[model samples]
Each structure stands twice: as structure tokens, then as C-alpha cells.
Target chain A: MSTKTETRKEEIIRIAAKLFKQKGYSAVTMRDLAKTMGIKAASLYNHIESKQAILQDVILTIAEEFTLGMASIQNQKASSTEQLKALIQLHVRIACHNPDGLAALNSDWMHLEDKLEYYLQLRNDYEANFRHIIERGIENKEIKNVDIEVILFSMLSTLRTLYLWIPKKDRLSEDELSASLTKILIEGINT
Target chain B: MSTKTETRKEEIIRIAAKLFKQKGYSAVTMRDLAKTMGIKAASLYNHIESKQAILQDVILTIAEEFTLGMASIQNQKASSTEQLKALIQLHVRIACHNPDGLAALNSDWMHLEDKLEYYLQLRNDYEANFRHIIERGIENKEIKNVDIEVILFSMLSTLRTLYLWIPKKDRLSEDELSASLTKILIEGINT
Candidate 1:
């Protein structure tokens, strides 16, 4: 694609993410996206192939970014505690950057027709890698001997929903948010 | 309403909750709901007024249940730690009983046209009560002096998303699930 074409495509994806986050994937139509963009629906088609294409672009890009972040963290020499902190920071930063896209990535990935399996694979792999880090934490005595699945589930639940919370909390810097989350999540609040 | 009418209305609501959870409130039409229930769309109107009515029923009912649960817990003489555990169990049990309704409550409450503001008030009140409990814990030194918002956010995020995880682990009883969550959430996992 030409530079202008690519820029327009990105703009379309951004607006579509906002709509998908608001009305959900199945409810958002190409015309709705075009209306939001102040472009004619026919003009939208000139830039993007289909509504599904917009969703695929919005979700896969964020999913891949997460996968890559996890991979990079996995290769580091940090302890599991540090590794988990890095993971939390990754989620917070990404969520702060594009909460609308993250919302689509969370709620609309199932709507990916041709790319459903690919998205699921990335999600499963990302989760598996997260669980591995927790398991290693237990083995290294960095974390308690709790049920691995419970710890994983609790942590993942909070991390996955960061996008919903980040937009409401615009005052906290990324580092401040990450540190607060790390302190609460990694270390229990019990005195 | 007569007992028979009430029963049929509830049945319609139950079936509608399932459809809403699967396809979301916006995507599931009255026809789709009626088809799922093996009834004519007109008959669906006999039981429930509209798709918005079904969503309002599903979400408002669950939200009210949480509100009531929190109210009862608030009157307890228990410590903050004990009260928080009760809150967790409340969420787990409610999610277990009506995972589909809970899913609708979480995701599709935005579609609760007439009841939207009421729902938002209930949600905000519920969070305020939760934060009050956490603040009490910090004051009593039951919980560490972490960011109250962070603790509240982390705990609520996990508790709110329990419906998404409960179905996959049917073997763990509600008590077991609640206990595991309490351990990881209230106590730090660090050794």
C-alpha cells in the first residue's frame, strides 16, 4: 500500500476500534465506522477491504504486540518477580496507549472469521507463557505454593481488564500505575 | 402476574440471557431469542417485552443481587479480611449460579436503555462499598498500606471477571474457588 493508503487504513482501524469497544464487534457496521470517520461508506471501501479486515487489523496487531512483549520478557535473565512486573508494565503501557483497540482485542477476537484460530493460538500461547512464569516463580520460591491455576487466573483476570480501568485513571503515570499494580498483585496487601 | 405467567417470563429471561451471553445483547434479536426457545417471535413478546427488556432483566437482576449481597455483608460483625472473603464468595457463588446473566451484566449493561443510569448507580455504589471495606482493612492494619485504589481495582477486576473463568473449572466447588482466590488476593504470593 502507498504511505497515504496505509495512514488512512490505520485511521479507519482506530475509529473502528472505538466503535467496536462501544457497541461491540457484531453490532458495529462499516457504515457506522464511516459515519464516525466523516467519510462516505464508498470512500471507506477505497481504503479498507471490509469490516472484518478492520477488526482483524485492530485485534491481531495488539495480540502480536503482547506475544512479542511476552517473548522478550521470557528471554530476560530477571527473576520471576521482576519478570511478572515487566509483564504488568507491558499490559499497562499498551492499555494506556490504545484502550479502544485493547477492548476490541479482548471482546471481539472471537468475531475474527478467518483469523479466529490464529488469534486463539496467540492467546493460548501468551497465557501458557504466563503460566510458565508463575510455575517457575513457585519452583524458585519467589511465589507461594498456591494453586498455579488460581494464581494464574487471578493475575490474568486483572491484567486482561487493565484497559477498562486505565482510561478511568488518567492521572497515574505508567510507571506509577505499574508499581502500584505490582505492589498489590505480586505482594499481597495484607500487613 | 400468575404463577404460570411468572414462570414463563423467567424461562424467557433465562433463555434470553444465554443468547445475550453468546451473541451479545445487540446481536441477538427477538427472533433469534424466540428461535432459541422454539417459540414464535410474537410469543416471545408475550413473555418479554423486547430485547432491551431481556437485557434489563438479566443485568439489573444480577446487579441488584450483588448490591443486596454487599448490603448484608456490610452489616456483618466480621473483620475486613473476613468481610472481603465473604464478598469473594458472594461473587463466586453468584457467577456459578448464573454465569450467563453475570456475563450480560458485565458486558451488555450498556444496552440497558431505560435502566442504564440506575445500573450505573448500582455499579458505582457497589464499587464504593468495596473500596470502603478495603479502606477499613488498611485502617485496621488488616491490609498493608498500599494504594487503596490499586487494591480495590485489582480485587474488583478479578472478582468481576469470575464468570469468564468459572465454567472451565467445574470440578472446583464454589467454596474451593472462593478460598483459592482469597488466598492469592488477600495474601501476597511471595514466599
Candidate 2:
């Protein structure tokens, strides 16, 4: 695609991400997106082929971003504890900055029709990175060896849910929040 | 209310919970709920005042049950660790039994109107019990002193998410699942 065409596709994808996050996938329509962008429905077709196409692009973009972020941590030379901290920080940062994309992944993931197979695979891979870290931590004696699946699930699920309780205004600043959560995850309250 | 009236109310709540879980609150209508229940829309009013009423009841009932279950644990002679295990087990058991109610709380909770302040308060009290256990555990050197917010959030969100992942034919019984999760939460994988 030409530079101009690529830029337009990017803009369309951004708007669709916002709408999908707020109204859900099934509730949003091609016309609604166009109206928000001050254009006609046919004009949107010039930018993207269909609403599902927009959804596919948006979801793929988010997954790709997450995979890239997590991969960067996995390649690091730190201890498992530091690596886990980095993963948590990166995830929370993405959630803080990319609320639209986060919402799409959390709320609109089920609307992908038959294409969910690919997305689910990507999600499993993403989860596997976390699982690998926990396993390494246990092997290295950094974390307990209680059930690996449960520990991994708790860390990921807890981090993901920050989106629900985090207030737009009063949320912990990146450093403070990460510091607090990391301490809790690593050392229990016993002493 | 008479026994028949109570039975009718329970029936209406059950139907509404199913519809709300399947279609979400905004998409479900009284007519649709009535049709699903094999009753007319007007006939629904004989048992419940409004769709919101039914929703409020469903959520409140779950919240109340959770609180009562936790209270019973508090009254028991178990150690802090055992109490925590019982709490986790009870939560998974409820999720298994009332998957629809759990789904409703997960997805359709924001749709409840202003009249549900009492139910929301009940939720706060229920959460307080979880927090209390963690606090007590911390003081007694039974649990870690990590952020109660993070630990509590992880426990509830992870268990609640069982709605999406837990299958009926799973080899692990609910108690087994809870036992594994509790082990992970209270003890890290360091060993």
C-alpha cells in the first residue's frame, strides 16, 4: 500500500478499536464508525473492506504488540524475579496506555467468528511465556513449586484484572504500582 | 410470601439470569426473557416488578451466599490456612453450581440500576471478609504481607474467570481445583 493508504488504514483501525472497546463488537457497525470519522459508509470501504476486517486487523495488532513486548522480557538476562517484574510492568503499561486495544482483547475477543482459532493460539503462546517464567523460577529456586499452572494463572489473571479496578485518574503511577505488586508477589506478608 | 409465590419468583430469577448471561443486559428484553420462560411479558410482572429487579435479586443472592459461606468459615475452628482453603473451595463450588450467576456478575454487573446499592454494599462486605482473612493471616505469620489488594484481586478474578475455562467433564473435581489454586496462592513456587 502507498504511504497515504497505509496511514488511512491505521487511522481506521484506531477508531474501530475505540468503538469496539466501548460498544462491543456486535454492537458497533460500519456506519457508526464512519459517522464518528465524519465520512460516509462507502468512504470507509475505501479505507477498510468490512467491519470484520477492521476487527481482525485491530485484534492482530494488539496480539502482535503483546507478543513483542513479552518476547523482549523473555530474551533478557535477568533472574526470573526480574523477568516476571518486567512482564508485569510491560502488561500494566500497555493496559494504561492502550486502553482501547486492551478493551478489544478483553471484551471483544469472542466476536472473531471462526477466526478465533488463530487468536486463541496466539493467546496460548502469550500465556506460555508467563508459564515459562514461573517454571524457570521454580527450577531456579526463585519461586515455590506449588502447582505451576495455578501460580501462573494467578499472576496473569491478577495483572489483567487491574483494568477493572484501576481508576483513570487515581491509578498508581507506573513505578509505584509495579513496585508494590512485585513485592507482594515475591514475598508473602509473614515477615 | 406464600410458597407458590416464592417458587414463581425463583423461576423468574433463573430465567433472567440465563438471558442476561447469554445475551448481556442491554441486549435482553423483558419480552425475550418471558418468551424464554414460556410466559407472557405481562405475566412476568406477577412474579417480579422489572427486569432490573430480577437482575438485582440474582446478583444479591450470589453476594449474600458468598458472604454467608465466608461467615461460616470464620466461625469454624480451622487454622488460617485451612480457612483460606475452605474459602477458595467454596468459591469454586459456587461457580460450578451457578455458572450463569457467575457470568452475570462478570459481564452484566454494570447494568444494575441505582436501586442496587444494598447489593453492592453486600459485595463490599463480602470482599471485606476476604481482606480480613489476609490481614489476619499476615498478622499471625500465616500468609505473606504482600499487597492485600493485589492478592485479593488475583484470587477473585482467577476464580471468577473459571466461567470461561472450566468444563463439566474436567478430570479435576471442584475441590481438587480449589486445592491446587490455594496451594499456589498461599505458598510461592520457591521450593
Candidate 3:
């Protein structure tokens, strides 16, 4: 694809993610996407195939970003604690940059028809990679000996929902968020 | 209402909450609720007013439970950490006992019609109560002097979504979950 066409596709994906966040995936139609873009429906088809295409593009793009982020973190030489902080920062940065896309990825991923299994695979692999990090931490005594599930669930729950919280808290500098979450999540709130 | 009628109404609400969790508030109907309960629509009405009533009942009951739980915790003479642990236990217990209703409240509370503002007030008041606890904790040096929103958001995000995680983790006993989460959520995860 030409650069201009690729940019238009990216723009369409961006706007569609916002709309999907507002009105859910099932409720949005091609006509709505066209209207939102101020283009004819035919032009939208020029850039994207269907609403499903946009859904896949929006969701898979973020999902792949996470996959790539995790791969990089895995290749790092940091301790598990520092690795976890890096993971937290990864989520915060993504959520800060593309909360609407993240929101769409969260709420509308289930609506993906063909790519559903692939999406779930990416999610499961991500979690397994995360779990391995925690396991390594436990073995090395970097993390406290606790039910790994409890720690995993608590951290994943908070991290997964960052999109919902970050928008409400834009005043928090990204550095502040990354640092504070590192302490609050890893260090326990107790002084 | 008579005792028998009240019991039946409770049954309807319970089933409806389960359905709402599976589907969603907008997709659920009185007809669907009746079908789930193995009763005709007309008979369902004898016990309840409308779909709005069921939603209000399910959500308010859980919301008010948190309100009451917070009130009871506030009445106690304990440290902020203890109070926060009590709050965590309160959420775990509620999520363990009524995961479905809690799920409905988390996701479908926005669909509430007549009671939306009241729900918001209850929610705001609840958050205010929580924030004050954190503020007190920070003042007394029981908690670290981090951004209150970061602590509050991290903790509340986990607590709010317990309903999603508990069912998958029914193997974790209620007492175990409460204690482990207190450690993981409050006590940082590091050694």
C-alpha cells in the first residue's frame, strides 16, 4: 500500500476505535464510520474492508503492541521487580497514548469473529510470560512467598484496567504514575 | 409482601442478575427473566414491577452492602491499614457470595434509569469515605505519602473487578483470598 493510503487506513482505524468505545462494536455500522470520517461510505471501503476489518485492526494492533512489549521485556537483564515495573510502565504508556484504542480492545475484543481465537492466544501467551516472570522472582526471593495467583490477579487486574483510570487522572505525570504504581503495586502501601 | 412472595421475588432477581451478567442489561428483558425463572411474564410481574425494578434491586442491594460495610468499618477503632484490610475483606466476601450480582452492578449499573443519580451519589459517597481513610492513613504515617488517586485507583480497580476473577478462582477459599489480597494489595509484593 502507498504511504498515503496506509495513513488513511490508520486514521480510519483510530476513529473507529473511538466510536467503538462510545457505542460498542455491535452497535456501530459502516455508515457510522463513514459519517464520522466525513467521507463517503465508498471511500471508507477503499481504506478498510468492513467494520470487522476495523475491529480486527484496532484490537490486533494494540494486542500486537503488547506482545512486542512483552518480548522486549523478556529479553532484558533486569531483576523481576524491575521487569514488573517495566511491564507496568508499558501498560501506562499505552493507556496514556491510546486509551480509546485500549478501551476498544478491552470491551470490544469479544466481538471479533475470525480473529477471536488468535486474540485469546495472544492474551494467554502474554499472561504465561508474565507468570513466568513472577515465578522467577519467587525462586530468586525477589518477590515474597505468597500465592502467586493472588499477586498475579491483583497486579493484572489493576494493570488491565489502566485505560479506565488514566483518562480520569491525566494530571498524574506518566513518570509519577509509573513510579507510584511501581511502589503501590510491588512494594505494598505500608511505609 | 408475604414471606413466600418475597422469597420468589428474590429468586427472580437472582436469576435476572445471572442473565444480566451473561448477556447485558440492555439485552435482558422481562420476558427473558421470566423464561429463566420458568414462569410466565404475567406471574413474574406479580412479584416485581419491571426490568428497571430488578436492576435497581440487584445493583442497590450490592452498592448498599458496600456502603453498610464501610460504615461498620468506619465505626471501628482500628488503624488505617486495618480499616483498609477490612474493606478488602468486605469486597472479597461480597464478590465470593454474589459474584453474578456484583458483576451486574459493575457492568450494568450504567443502564440504571430512575436510580442512576442515586447510584452515583452512593458511589461518590463511598469513594469519599475510602479517600478519607487513605488521607488519614497518610497523615498518621500508616500509609506512604504517595498520590492518593494512585493508591485509591489501584486498590479500587482490583476490588471493583473481583467479581470477574473470583469465579475463575473459586478454589481460593474466601478467607485465603481476603488474607492474600491484603498482603498483595496493601503489603507490597516484594520481600
The alpha-carbon lDDT assigned to residue A32 of candidate 3 equals 91
User: Of the candidates numbered 2 and 3, which has the greater TM-score value?
Assistant: 3
Rank by TM-score, highest first: 3, 1, 2
DockQ per candidate: 0.70, 0.40, 0.89
Docking class of 1: medium
Task: Please report the candidate that would top lDDT against the real structure.
Answer: 3
Error of 1 at A172 (Å): 0.6
Instruction: Mark the regions of model 3 whose C-alpha exceeds 4 Å error after superposition.
Output: A1-6, B1-6
| Rank order (by lDDT, best first) | 3, 1, 2
Q: CA lDDT of B9 in candidate 3?
A: 79
Taking the tens digit of each residue's C-alpha lDDT, what string does model 1 give over B67-102? 999999999999999999999999998989999899
Q: Residue A133, candidate 3: how far off, in angstroms?
A: 0.6
Top model by DockQ, which number?
3
Report the number of backbone clashes for model 1: 2
Model 2 Cα lDDT, one tens digit per residue, A29-122: 9999999989889999987888988888888777888788888888889999888889878877766666676778788888887678989988
